[model samples]
Target: MAWMSLLVAGLLEVVWAFSMKQSAGFTRLGPTVVTLVAMLASVALLAWSMRVLPLGTAYTVWTGIGAVGAFAVGVIVLGEPLNPGRVVAAGLIVAGLVLMKLSSAG
Candidate 1:
């Protein structure tokens, strides 16, 4: 359950990050509001997950998920570059996250 919450929080983090791009320095009312709301929800869920999950583990997983998710969204939805280096780096992040999860299970 805590892991699930962390995943949701991470997803929300991605949403808020993308929304921030559209915020136009907070000049755009709709995107700004959406960003704020998503950010708040992300934080809330992260905090809740921390109650049951170790802080270090939860934070690492949440951040890893957010980073990967945001990068994918940028590449797919925004037509951002998906250079070989970027792809390799993302794969490394996923590998690291998997390793962390496996270690933590012990």
Candidate 2:
């Protein structure tokens, strides 16, 4: 399913983003490789999903999922700051994503 592919692509986006941070500006070897691999897969799946989904919907949802997922990982794993404002922003992104999915014909 295109939507399923998009979801997986979004998750892969999170993986790549975290790994990219771990890569330390490509100074590290292992994390750099992981980042590159995940990035490729994420883009590939996103492109696949785009075959069926609207471009705006697919791109927006992909970025939204990645943004929220990376935010969670940053807070939980990296111990980044988690304030009320950031929480509300992430919630709003989720709200928009929900509305986008609901409005989609697919």
Candidate 3:
């Protein structure tokens, strides 16, 4: 349950980040509101997950998830450059997150 919450929080973090871009420095009202709400929800879920998960592990995984997700969004939806280095970096982040999850299981 905690893990699920953390994962959701991470995904929300991605959404919040994209919405922030769409918000155009908060000049756009709707996306700005969505960004703020998603940010709060993500943090709330992170706090809920931290009740059981180790702080370092939880925080790292959360940010890793957000980073990779945001990168993918930037490439796919935003039509940003898709370079090998960026892809490899994102893959490495996922690998690290997987290692962390596996280690946490024990």
The regions of model 2 sitting more than 4 angstroms off are none
Clashes of each: 0, 0, 0
Ranking by lDDT: 2, 3, 1
TM-score of each: 0.94, 0.98, 0.98
lDDT of 2 at 103: 98
Q: Model 2 clash pairs?
A: none
Clashing residue pairs for model 3: none
Model 3: ten consecutive residues of lowest lDDT: 97-106
lDDT per model, in order?
Answer: 0.91, 0.97, 0.96
Candidate 2: tens digits of C-alpha lDDT, residues 1-106 = 9999999999999999999999999999999999999999999999999999999999999999999999999999999999999999999999999999999977
For model 3, the local distance difference test gives: 0.96
What C-alpha RMSD separates each model from the true structure? 1.3, 0.5, 0.9
Instruction: Quote the positional error of residue 56 for candidate 3 in Å.
Output: 0.7
Candidates 1 and 3 compared by TM-score, better number: 3
- lDDT score at residue 106, model 1, on the 0-100 scale: 19
